[model samples]
Target: MKNVTRRSALGMVVAAGGATFLAACGAQPQATSGNASESASGSASASASVSKSVRSDYSGVAVLEGYTSKPSDYQPATRTEPSKNAPVPVKPAVANENSVEGLYQSIAFFGAAMEYYMRTGKTEPLRESALDNSELKSILEPEKGTLGDGMQQGKIWMQDPSVTITMLSAQPERDGDAYNWDIRLTTDTGEFIASKDRVEEASSDDDRKTEVERTLHGVYENGAWKLTGMRTSSSSSSSASASASDS
Candidate 1:
């Protein structure tokens, strides 16, 4: 199930870092307004913040409060930065148990949690889950830093986005005292499940979803399964109407 060639879909999407940025601030000081007016008289880009980079001192930066008519009527949204108040993603209770089925559920939970953070700009859930210097943290922490930068610059994150993580079927081998699932995971939304009539998809979305099948090295530790490390097995885009794998 391991492939050295592929990186994570989550990483790919986040690394793109093409979040939307607002041109003008909702409010700026009177002194700053004069400078903004001066800049506006010169060039469009000079009077507004366009890039995804933040400055140490915003006062010096000319931010024209967009006023089409009455300045009072055009109240631009006051989203200075990400609200950072997204509710923490709830982890599945079954993930805490040290068992085979529990391991499967735990891996699924991690997939869901990571996607949630990326989609909604929710940091708490990923922060809580990616821990212990395991492989998952290494893969995800860099993405976290990218998101942080976007937030600081007041850039809107994840527009019309789609992401999916498929836990592949593979055999687990023992690693020391802990078991190691040398993670060959991901494929179509639905994968083979000979044991049952159906499998609970880890997650699926219709918003331009990125199809990511990455091999995750899973380990059971402290009574839960954790993603230790990973390599990409495959990466592609999922059709909006693509049906789950029935085979």
Candidate 2:
């Protein structure tokens, strides 16, 4: 099967954030410098609201940057075709609980939850998964301690996607062993698949980076997309910890 790497998956998430931000801004009144000053004062008056906005822990893969105002430079250049050797799609006896969009949205939340854990050294109640029992247990396990001191201080921006993800591949069944499955996604940023290999980089022999890929099966649960598997690359674990330190 065709594999799209991690960088591309992250890029897709960033693109989606960007699009959401733009739509929000477009719906609001444009602010001038004078308005900015006034807004600052008004914001302080509602410090409670501002404090609530400060989310240190997030549920899914944490993207440190917030959504960007400008468009992203990265774009998808290719498309993926299903393998002829692959098994045919199966219609499960149960109806799907999560839409494709809902699945992506839950992924974003999962990212946020990881961030929260790193920041507070506390583990929140993870959303239960319908796909993999073992994977779900791993995600829900309580932490012995904080991942590090606390979250790093910085504003993470998510860039808007140049395209939208129109299709996602069928969910792969979870066996006792871990396997890589590339899911095709179309985004405004470009077309890409969620692949672990795409974001890996080779380092010196003595300091090779390990990559961990978590799988989250989207299940229709609790009226939303619940992640069934949680994969974390060795590279991603380091990056996530580092992001907390840097923030």
Candidate 3:
């Protein structure tokens, strides 16, 4: 009788132990699964939040979209003037004769001229240069001419001096078939003003970039340099035109 009682007690204890072990095994799997689900959900939520933040921060400007990097192409070659009151260096007379640098400077100034027009919505007076007369006549004309009519209606701000123009090399050679340029512009004034970046490709292609190069016909008008006409480069046309109109 004593032996049977001991055996029965041992059997009861073993059964209870087995039940506890089974319960622990079941609970562990469920808890682990729940934890993994929560972790994944948290990660997904974080990703969504980041995406929303990026979308919200972007301004609805056309120029900001295509700009992948900052402009660091041209370092200051030389400082012509140290004082603000001093006259800036003028393009050399000998260097101005059908030189690539002359063209580059002309194109750069044309951008500034367009900015000036955008602000006033009237034809700015031309500076004297050796540009083609016919080209000057075309943009100066009031009706169909580009510089005359305001392209868009809005307040526009001029870009700061931080704006840089870089000429890119298409071919490996120094004198390649065609050239490319990237213009970076910035403004930190107020909400009415925003930053912009423009990249223009001036190839022989019939594309808009090419049109910009063709249309940028200039002449040396008065004693100062002036742009007679400009064809908007593909990269900067919309932004430049809009900014000019706004100004």
Best by lDDT: 1
Candidates ranked, most accurate by lDDT first: 1, 2, 3
In candidate 1, where is summed lDDT lowest over 10 consecutive residues?
21-30
Selected candidate, larger lDDT, 2 vs 3: 2
TM-score of each: 0.43, 0.29, 0.27
- The 10-residue segment of model 3 with minimum total lDDT is 21-30
Clashes (N, CA, C under 3 Å) per candidate: 4, 47, 15
Q: lDDT tens digits, residues 1-247, model 1?
A: 1110111323333222111111111101011111111211123322322121223222111212221111232222222322233222345443444444444444544544443443344444444442234433433333222322332233433322222343333434456645454332222211111111221222344322333333445554444456544333243431111111112
The Cα local distance difference test for each model comes to: 0.31, 0.25, 0.23
* Candidate 3 global lDDT: 0.23
What shift in Å separates residue 82 of candidate 2 from its native position after superposition?
Answer: 47
| Most TM-score-accurate candidate | 1
Candidate 2 — what's its lDDT? 0.25
Q: Please, what are the lDDT tens digits per residue for candidate 2 over residues 173-202?
A: 333432222322222212222112232222
Q: Which residue pairs show backbone clashes in model 1?
A: 6-232, 135-228, 162-209, 168-185
